[model samples]
Target chain A: MRLRNGPAASVRYEGILRICAIGLAVFSLLSWLLLGANRGWTKTTRTRWQKDPVTEIEGPLIEKAFLPGVDLLAVGLSGALILFVVSLLVTKNKTNSNQVNSSS
Target chain B: MKNKFVAALGFIALAATAFAAPLEFDFKDPKGVNNVIFKTDAPLESINGTATGISGNVTFDPDNPGAVKGKIVVQSASLHLGNPMQKEHLHSDKWLDVTRYPEITFEVESAKNVKTEGNVTTADVGGKMSLHGATKPITVPVKMTFLKDKLKARTGKEGDLLVIRANFKIRRSDFRINPGQMEDKVSDDIELNLSIAGAAPRG
Candidate 1:
């Protein structure tokens, strides 16, 4: 099959970028929620550890380690989303300009 | 009347002393007790690993609610993962580049006692997390217990060992680990989990 040219290609590119942008946004939001939720879980666990004075039977192992510079990851993801959107907009604008120029 | 005043002052001082609890950690244990785990969602064949050879100090006084101080560091090159091929790939120029960036460090900002129930005290420890070459501010919920000379801590528990547990998603692109030709195979969002244990302090 022959591939579409000019406007078609641009359209496909824009669509891919838009999808990527949305995906990144959703991923970032979910990350924030998970972190917050984990914090809540930690609080509850601490309460349980203190209140329920039971035997230390090694129920389930608890993992606690810091991810150095994680905030940068969040910020960087945000930036990537922004860049993806901007590129799509710029590509669409250029496509429109080319179409107008050709028509004129 | 005079005796009552002195008794009240003494009570306050005693309460303050009872609240102070400081502990140190040694990471020489081979049971994976002191290892630090880090995760990233980048869809690369391998982007997650564990860091061992940890050595640090943590001094915390829960009673005062403001005297918490500590520093921890993990040798960056010590990070190990599932397979040998993956390990070599990670240490290569594509990811950690272990030869260049050798250590991940954390500097304590402030530790505040959020809630205390009996012997267990939960504190919100805010500080800077540095990895690769970037540093960011992060707040970790640290639950600690003072047992004689040994101190045990539980953080971010998801059916894992207690000491430190963190779950945060990161983008590999941020650290300049872009998916150039094989973008589809590798994901940009990476989820991280960390579990660490520290040794108790000595007199």
Candidate 2:
């Protein structure tokens, strides 16, 4: 009795990867929301520029607004999500190949 | 009548001859000026850089020993780390917040001359360091060389910039930056280095 490389295995892998991707996306989004709700970024930008020529020219320059930790988390989670999606696609392709081979 | 007239004339002449002296700096030609460098070390990496803004007067009179005082303010936000991500993190809200508190100011509290070693004049300078909206007292050991029309004081330099250098750690949490998810990723202790140069007055 041969173990089948069929729809069952593909479905399981797909489900797992989807769950992982969703979890990471949710975590990243939640962090962004929580950070905003806490007004953490607000503290850094509270100072207003006076109407001075130097400030007028430089004030519009946008600096890094995300906290280091949050930025890291967001990047890390984004990478993981991308990898998982890629892996899911690869697994689906492999499963299709196996199905074709069995039919032939 | 002739003697009384001469006495009044002599007193007036002596008073008129007195002249106000110009500001004289003992170290007229500072070996170096406007050269100060600060560095930080971390487990993952180390960051080191020099500051461009330095202005102050140093009047050292051995006999009279007049007070020597000055102020140094480094644009905290201008500090550059090798990594752009790290630099951004440093200036972000979780760290230095360079936008809101753009400058790291250090005002000389006191400069006491230590034992003279050859031409080098070592002074312990006490001052307040304001960073991240918090001010803390810091003492910097400064070795100054009096050059013609310049005063060169250095903290750390090895083929990079100067000689005078200091190493101290500052906890980000102490300045009200608490550790949390993203904040916890970075080390609390940060190292600082100060290298400075100033124009020496001409005789």
Candidate 3:
């Protein structure tokens, strides 16, 4: 079976990959901005409690410091980075393949 | 007539001495267990935080729970969020402005509908809540538990302990906290939960 190794096909494929990568990155950036751009780990739980040793009283000791949408930012950015790297690799392969084919 | 008046005064003084005075429980817990949790839920976001710098005094009389009175003060700076940027914004002028208002205070004026069961007493507490440079009258449902001679067990000091728990809601607009702003991300109604244990150590 023959593969689609034409220059135009390769170029079109690379363009699609690049466009998808950029879209992912833009979406991640916008989501992060909207979520307040948390610099720490994301959390969703509403409340936490700590028990006092002396008083033996349990009360809300911590609250959700990271907002709800922060996790979305983290996941989105990570996915965008992966896609961007994949796109870069795809473009590099296409260039290498074209150079070899022209030389042959 | 003079002799009778002297005798009456003596009797009155003896009676007063026999009546126990209300115990002043100090809410400044060295154990750092006293805390106030606040939450506000909106369509776009839910904001929650905890304040641990609590200090105040409440005069509680086990025999008369309805007569409870005191003040609770929370340091405005102690209101904390998990995110540093969000925490800073909360304390900024756009929100609480902690520098301008150094403290959030509640002065208990009266208690009503008090009912005592075992060591716990429940009541409707009326007080003046001062927050964000505004003071407003509010009523909250409070549950107080009097632990006689329990201070020694908790703090290794011979004393009595009073545990107080309350759940209430307040309107941020009432305190002029960025009124009519951020209603979508931050709700106007703020729910507060208070838990504290006050100790009155004895010699």
- What's the best-to-worst order under lDDT? 3, 1, 2
True lDDT of residue B3, candidate 1:
98
The candidates score, on chain A by TM-score, as follows 0.50, 0.49, 0.58
TM-score of 3: 0.73
Candidate 3 lDDT over residue span A2-94, tens digit each: 126766666676678678878877887876676666544354434567786645577665544445355667677788777777766667777
Number of the top candidate by TM-score? 3
Q: Write the per-residue lDDT of candidate 2 for residues A1-104, one digit (tens) a residue.
A: 12256566666666777777877777766766765533221233221222212111111122344432444465758866786876578576766767888999
Q: Any runs in candidate 2 off by more than 4 Å, and if so which?
A: A1-104, B1-38, B42-50, B56-59, B62-66, B149-167, B177-185
Of the candidates numbered 1 and 3, which has the greater TM-score value? 3
Instruction: List the DockQ of the predictions in order.
Output: 0.02, 0.03, 0.24
Which scores better on lDDT, 1 or 3?
A: 3
TM-score of each: 0.50, 0.48, 0.73
> Judged by DockQ cut-offs, is candidate 2 incorrect, acceptable, medium or high?
incorrect
Model 1 alpha-carbon drift over 4 Å, by segment: A1-104, B1-32, B42-48, B64-66, B151-162, B179-183
Which candidate ranks first by DockQ, i.e. highest? 3
lDDT of 1 by residue, A1-104 (tens): 12246566666767777777777766766665664523211121110111111213111223443221335346747876786877667586757767776999
Per DockQ, what order, best first? 3, 2, 1
